[model samples]
Target: MSEVAIIGAGYYGFKPITDEVSFREGTFLAAMRAYEQCNIDPRKDVDSFIACEEDFNVGIAISNEFAVDQLGGVLKPVSTVTSESLIGLASGYMLIKSGLCDIVVVEAHSKASNLVSPEKILEFAMDPVYERFLNFHPNYLASLEARNYMEKRGISNDDLALIIKKNKENGLLNPRASYSITVDLEAVKKSEKIFDPLSEYDIAQYTDAFVVVVLASKEKAEKLSNKPVWIEGLYWCSESSLTPLRGFSTNALELAAQKVYDRTNLNPKYIDFFEIDDRFSYRELMHIEALKVSNKDTIKKDLREGRFSKEGDRIVNASGGYLATGVPLDAGGLARVYEAFLQLRNEAGQMQLKNANRCLIASWRGIPTSTYAVCALSNGA
Candidate 1:
C-alpha cells in the first residue's frame, strides 16, 4: 500500500459560540486555511474530498451540500461518511493508497448551536427494537459503563475528577479550547452531578466548531513541504450494535489499537503524544486502558502521577481533548487528527511536545454504539 501524509491541518471555532460565521462558513474558512498552509491550490491540487457529518446535528438533510461551495468541492468527487470524522479520514487515506487520488481533503464540522436538544439527537442513536424501549437518557448508559469500569478496575470518582481537572488546566494553554478553566479535585467533586458519579464537568461541553485536514500521497507530500507527518497505520472497528448484548466495559478501541500496532510495527511505549476521544471523563480512563498504554486497574493511578501530562514522556491530549476543548460532534475526531499533525510538524505552539516523533489518535462514537477508529502517525513518511 502507498503511504499517505498529512501536509497541512487547520481549525476554526470561537472559544464560545460565535455569530460572526455560519457553520458552513466556518468549515470553508478552515478548509481554505489548511489548503493555503499546505501551499496547495484547492482548484488544482485536490483530487477528492471526504466530509464527515450527520443529519440531526446540522439541521439539514444533506449537510455536505452546505459545505461544498466553500470547500472548493463543487464539481469534484465528494462524499459524506456518516460516521466519526476520523473514519472519513481513514477513507481518504485508503483512497490515496488505492492509487486513485493523490490529494484528498477531509472536512468535518458541528454546529451544536443549532441543536435545541442534543439529548433528542442522541436518543435517535439508540437501538429502536430493544434499548430505546428503556427510554434511558444517554448519560444513564455512560453512567452504567462508568459504574462497571469502576467496579471491575477499582477506579474511584476522585480519579475521574483528577482527569477532568488536568484536561481543563491543559486547555488553558490551548487558545482554540472553549472551556479552559482551573478546577481542583474538590471543585470537580462538588460540581453538579449529571449521572450518579459523573458531574457536569465530567462530560464534554457542546460547541460550534469545524476542522479540516489535507492529505497527500507520499510523492506529492515530499515535493510540497519539507515536513510531512506520515500516516503510518490506520484501523477502525465496530462491536455489536446492540449494547445490552456486549460487555459494557469492553471497548472496540483495543481491537483497533492492536490492528494499528501490528500494521505500523509500533508499541504503546513508542508513542510520544496521543489524542483520545474523551467525551466523558471516564472515557479517558477507559481508552487509556483499551489502548494498553497502562493497565486498566492502574490508569487512574498513572493519571494522578502525571504520566499522561503534556510535558510528560507520553503526552496525552495536548490539545485539551474533547473534554476541555469542546465536543463538536462529528468534527471532534478530525480535531484530534489536526492536533497530531500540528505536534508532528512542530507547529503546535505552546502545546507542542518536546522532540515528538510518533503519535496516536483514537476516536469513538457515543455510548450504545461500539464504533471506533485509531491511527498511528509519525514524522517520517
Candidate 2:
C-alpha cells in the first residue's frame, strides 16, 4: 500500500545557464505550475513545504528562507533540507505516513551559473582537515572511483564510451536534454582526457533547473489527479565521508536499494524501468550494480544487447539522464523521479515508454559524498 502519491510535478530550465530568472523566480514558476495542476493553493491546502538545496550552492544561509514566499508558504510550516532533493522526497513521504501532513510540497533546483567555481563548494563538503587541505580538484574523487571500478569490473574505455554514446543519442529524443547530441562511440573515445580513466565526455556538466512535486495521501491524490504515481517504498543511506573509508563502488546506493526492495517486497526483476544516477558516466553502471539489477559481471552484456535501452528489456534512463540533461545540482534525483512520473502517467511525450507502470530510482549526492536515496514507484495501483 502507498501512503504517498505524487499528484503533480513542475519544472523549468534544463540548460547550462538560466539567466532569465533568479533562483526564487524560477522556483516560483515551477511551483505555480505544480499547484495549478493539482488545483491547490500552497498557502491553504499544503500542510508543509520542503525545499532541498545546499546553502553554499545558493550563496545564502537557510536555503529555504527566500523560497517560502514564492512557494506560498508564508507564515506556514516550511523546512529546508541540505541533502539531495531525493531525500526531500523521502521527507515528504514520512510527513504523510506520520499523519502530520496530508498535502506536502517539495522543491529543488540549481543555479550553477551563479558559481564561478562550483567545485569549490564540493571541497567544503569534503573532510576539511584531510581532503580539503590537499587542494586537489574534487573530481579526483570521481576519477579515482572510476579507475578502481574499471579495474575491478574489467570495464574498458570502449565500455564507458558506449554509455556516453547511448545516453547522448537518447537525449536527441528528449526535449529537456540541453546537452543532448548524437555523438558516435569513436568521437566519445577521442574526447580530451581530463583525468586518467575519466574523459571530458565521461563527466556530466552542470545545468540550471527547478523541480517541484506535490505529494498527498492516497485518497487526496486520487482526487487531485486522474493518475498519481504512488510511492511504494523509499529509503536513504549515507556512507563514511572520509576518502579511505569509501569503497570503489557506491555501497550506500546499494544499501538503500536493498532496503527499499525489502520494504516493497519487490526487486529489479519485478520493475518495469529504472532511472538511477548518472552524474558520472560510470556511476550509472556502478549504481546498476548497487541496485542489484545488474553488475560488473553482467552489465557489459546488458549494454551491448540493448537491455537498458528504450527497446530493451530494462529501459533505463529514458529521460536522457544527466549525461544529456546536464546535472541539475540537488534536483538531479528529483528530475529522474519526475521523468519516471511522467512515463507512469503517460505524459512523457516522445520519450514515453509503452506500458510503463513501475520505476526504480536511485540518486547519489555527486562526488566526495556517499549519501544516497532510492524509491519504488507505481502508476497508482
Best candidate according to TM-score: 2
> Candidate 1 — number of clashing residue pairs?
0
Give TM per candidate: 0.96, 0.97
- In model 2, the number of clashes is 0
Residue-level lDDT for 181 in candidate 1:
85
Q: What TM-score would candidate 2 get against the native?
A: 0.97
lDDT of 1 by residue, 1-381 (tens): 678999988878834575789887898889889988889988878999999988888889987677677788888999989999999999999999999999999999888877888887888888889778877778888888888887887888888877787788888878878787888777777777768778788888887878999999989998987898899999999998887888684458899999999988899998888899888988888888889898866676688798888756667787888777888887778888888888888888888778778899999887757999999999973
**Tens digit per residue, CA lDDT, model 2, 1-381:** 347999999998888999999998999998998889889988789999999978899998877788788899999899988899999999999999988889999999999989998988888888877778779888988888889888887888888887887788888988789999988777777877787788979888999999999999987997888888899998999988787676665778888999999989998998998998888888888888889878768987887787888888887788889999999899998899889988999989888888888999898888888899999999954
- The per-model lDDT (C-alpha) reads 0.84, 0.88
List clashing residue pairs in candidate 1: none
Q: Which stretches of candidate 2 lie over 4 Å from their true place?
A: none
Q: 359 in model 2: Cα distance from truth in Å?
A: 0.4
